[model samples]
Structures are given as C-alpha cells and as structure tokens.
Target: MPSPRRTARQADLLERLVALLVAEGFASFTLDDLAERLRCSKTTLYQLAGTKQDLVREAVKHYFRGAADAVEKEIAETVDPASRVQVYLTTVAEQLSSLSRAFLDDMAQFPPAREVYEANTRLAADRVRNLIAEGVAAGAFREVHAAFVGEVAAATMRQIQLGEVGARIGLTDSEAYEQLASLIVHAVSS
Candidate 1:
C-alpha cells in the first residue's frame, strides 16, 4: 500500500528518521523507541507507514532516493566527462559513509529494502557506463571496452556490499569504497 502524503513536518521527520536508521537501524528499534528518537508520537510514526516493517521499507527507499538525487545533481554540475565517473563513484562512497553495519544487517533481513539497494547499484553501473561513453566521445578516456569496465565496477561494488572487502582486508565498507573511488578516479585520469 502507498503511504499517506507526508506533510512538511513528516518530511522533516523522515529525514531525521533516515539519519537515525543509517546510524543505528530500525530492526532493533521498537515503535516506542522510534517515537522517542524521532521526537514524535507512535501515532505520528504510524502515519508514515502502516507497520514497523513498512516504515523501515519506506525509510530505506527514502534514503536511496535522496542519495540518487544528490549523486545525479553532482554529476550534472560537473564539467569534465572523465571526472563525471569519478564524481559518480565518490558520491556513492560519501553516501556509504553514513551507513552502519547494523543498518546493512537490517536491510539484509528485509528483502524489499535490499532490493532497493540492489536497484541503486545497478543504476550506478549504468551511470558509470554512460560516463565512460561520454569520456570516450570527448577524447578524455582511451578507446576501451565500456561494458567490461562497467561490469567490473558493478561486481566490485557487489563484493563491497557483501562485506567481502571488509571481511578479508579488515577495512570498513566506507573505507573500502573511499579507496575504490580513489582508485577509479586515478585510473580514469587522462
């Protein structure tokens, strides 16, 4: 079911809620806990969604939507086509910084929220491909296989999301992403 239209107050509350969920996660938070942390009543919380799971799903979607918007805005304002790819990847890294392990775990437990994350990653890969094409057209990047590059980036991102990087290297997901962005930018530099 669709959520009710959020008033300005509710929209503001959703931002706060996303921040909280990013840091702590909703899986462990009861409705009362959410009300306390979000500084609203249980009734107000229910207004956001029909149930706690529903609330969490909406919150995850909201977070991804906001992140996607910000990433697109950053890419749009960028002047260099080669740098667009860098900005795209690094913007995602910056967004990943706010995500805590608990939050990731919560999403893993919730398939719908996980699907939202996966969809964003797929879109990210597509954006990477587009940036590569732009760079090639502008003579900023070498004539290389953009599809192969995109697939590699997408796979690397998948491993990162699965915590394989952290599991093997003892680096946090955010740190891994930061390094990945740096490496990608350096590689793409003319």
Candidate 2:
C-alpha cells in the first residue's frame, strides 16, 4: 500500500531530517538529539516515523529517491547513448560525493539503510545495462554483454561505496565513479 500523504509541515520536517542525517550521520543521534537538533519535539518526529531506526531508514530512502530522480532528469536531456551513460554515472557521482564518511559508515553498519543502498545499486546497474544496450542498438558502442558489464559496474560501485576504492587507490567515491564512467564509455565505444 502507498503511504499516507505528508502535511506541509511534516514534509518540511522530513526534508530537514534527510539533510541532517546526510550531513551529520544518524548512527550517533538519539531521538532526543534529533528533536533538539531539528528544533522540533520528539512528538513531531514520530509523525514522520515511528522509531529512530524507521526515521533513519525513511530519511535514507528519501535521499536516494531524490538522487535517482535528479539523475533521471539529467538523463532525459541527453540524446547520445554514450553520453547518457556518462551522464547517468557522473550524475550519480555528483549526487553521492556530498556524503560524509560518518554518514557512509553509518549506512554500512545499519542493515535497513544498507539494504536501501544495495537496492539502489542494483537499480543503478540495471540502468547501466539498459543504457549499454541502447548504445549497442544505436551503433554507438561495440557489441558486448550489457548485463555482465552492468554487474561489473555494480561491483565497482559496491567497492567504492565501501571505501575500498579510497583505501586502495586514494580515489574518492566521486572520482572513482568518474573513472568508471570514462572507462565504460571507452571500452564500449567502437
């Protein structure tokens, strides 16, 4: 079932919650801390979500949904399939580059939030696969296994999100994604 609609105030509060969690991370914050930081009562927050974990999950979902929408909006404007692939990944990189380490670590540790991220990663991989397929169909890219390439891209994204890319190569998540976009485009181009 669809969720009930939020009132303007509730919507505003949820937006604030998403921003706060993204900027500061949610793992250390208590409900009381959130209420105080948001300048609203705990009661107000309960209207947004039942518990702290639920609130964090909701906020994470809100963030990713918005990011996906923005990426799609950018993709809609680009005409070339190869350019679309680059735009899609780079746009995602731009969206994610703002995340703080604390927020990312918290996401990794929190099962619900982690699941949201994983699901989004899979969605992203599917998107990449489709984009690759389109490129091949348009004769913009050489024939390749789009599904396999998408999974490879997803695996690289997983590593980037886990901070492994940063640890091993000293590349920030955004930089790694940019590299991935370029590499994919180059490898696929005829």
Best by TM-score: 2
Model 1 clashing-pair count: 0
TM-score of each: 0.90, 0.96
Q: Give the alpha-carbon lDDT of every model.
A: 0.83, 0.91
Q: In every candidate, how many clashes are there?
A: 0, 0
Local accuracy of candidate 1 as per-residue lDDT tens digits, 1-190: 4456879999999899999999997688999999998889999988888898888989998999889889889988999887888788878888888899999878877887888888887888888877887887898888877787778788888777777788899877678767777776666656
TM-score of model 2 (CA atoms): 0.96
State model 1's lDDT.
0.83
Residue 46, candidate 1: Cα error in Å is 1.6
Cα lDDT tens digits for candidate 2, 67-107: 99999999999999879999999999999988877898899
Q: Which 10-residue window in model 2 sums to the lowest lDDT?
A: 1-10
Off by over 4 Å in 1: 1-4, 186-190
What pairs collide in candidate 1? none
Candidate 2 global CA lDDT score = 0.91
Model 1 — TM-score against the truth? 0.90
RMSD of 1: 2.0
